[model samples]
Target: MANPTACLLIIGNEVLSGRTRDANLQFLATRLGELGIPLREVRVIPDVEATIVATVNEVRAKYDHVFTTGGIGPTHDDITSECVAKAFGVPWVVHEETRALMAEDYARRDPPVEMNAARMRMATLPLGAVPIRCAMTSAPGFTMGNVHVMAGVPRIMQSMFEALAPSLTGGVPVVSRAVHAIGVFEGNIAEALEAIQKRHPDLDIGSYPFYRPTPGSTGFPGGGVALVSKGVSLAEVEEATAEITAMLAAMGATPIQGEPG
Candidate 1:
């Protein structure tokens, strides 16, 4: 059977404004791949309620699983939880268990912090949502239907995902093989690469050019093209990689196994 597909929604104004770079997409993509859920689409939107609600509704119907990160904090702009609730047409309510947990933790603070309205906001979730708890914080992310909401902080997000991963269903994990053609420009092998891709239509064949500056030689920065073949079947990936290796050798370039250095 084909692996389940997933979509990631990164919600934050800081990300769009370039004030904070998004660090969750790559991590989620890689981890989802390992769990046999291919991350097929990603959308980065500001903390606009309409946009977040519309995007959440759109992608949740399109993909088997949906992950959202950001805007679940105490600040005013942190509105992803409410937006998601709106998307699901569920009333946003406070989760008592999470609120109780947070209250307990806050009581143990050095200064005995109070669970103010802002801090209590983190415990609020969509009606009927299941809390996704992590060790990093008392406040929890939640799972509402197929959508898994997580914190935007990389460390906290990763912990939430780790806690939630075991419950997820998966299929055969996708695999990849790569060969770097040293000293070969992409133009030198574009036609051959296209031919290879045509021959293996089931696999994803890609050529990426990179520059690796030689220690002392200032000659064109010394780079090459990397040919990667990705698929669910290891045999198919190996077969396509072998063809790529042969193509590079035919062009008089040494094909180095794996990624470019």
Candidate 2:
């Protein structure tokens, strides 16, 4: 069977404004790849209610799984839960079990933390949603239909994903093989790479160029191209990688086994 497909919806004004860099996409993409769920698309939207509701409704229907990060905290700007509820056309209410759990955990604090209205907001979720518990914080993420909501913080988001990973259905895990051609430009190998890609239409073939400064040198920087082949079939990836290596060798460039240092 084909692998399950996923889309990551990153919701935060900080990310779009470049004030805070997004670290969740890479982590989620890698984890999903390991589980055989390919991350097909990623969209970074601001913390707007209408946008979040619209995006949630859109991606949830398009992909097998949709993950959203950010705006789930207790602060006033945290409105993803209600927006999701609006998107699903469900009532937004305080989830009783999650509320009780958070209350108990907070009561055990050294100072006996209070469940204020703001803090209680963290326990709110859409009707018929399942709370996702994480090791990092008392506040929980939640899953509604195909949409899995998670924290914006990298540590908390990773914890939530790990907690939720077991429940996800997957398919054949994708693998990759790379060949680095030393001192070779992508323009020199683009045609060959395209031909190889055409021959293996099921695999993803890509060529990336890199350059590094030589210490204490005024001359031009040294660089090379890294050709990568990815697919569910290990044998196909290996074959494509070998073809790329041979192509680089035929062009009189030294082909290394992996990415350039």
Candidate achieving the largest lDDT: 1
Per-candidate local distance difference test: 0.92, 0.92
What TM-score goes with each of the models? 0.96, 0.97
C-alpha displacement of 90 in model 1, angstroms? 1.1
| Candidate 1 C-alpha lDDT tens digits along 1-261 | 788999999998899999998999999999999899999999999999999999999999999999999999998999999998899999999999999999999999999988999998999999999999999999999999999999999999999999999999988888999898778888879998999999999999988888888898875457888799998889999999999999888878889998655
**Which prediction has the highest TM-score against the true structure?**
2
Runs of candidate 2 exceeding 4 Å displacement: 215-220
- Backbone clashes for every candidate come to 0, 0
lDDT of 2 by residue, 106-167 (tens): 99999999999999999999999999998888899999999999999999999999999999
Error of 1 at 138 (Å): 0.9
Cα RMSD (Å) per model?
Answer: 1.6, 1.3
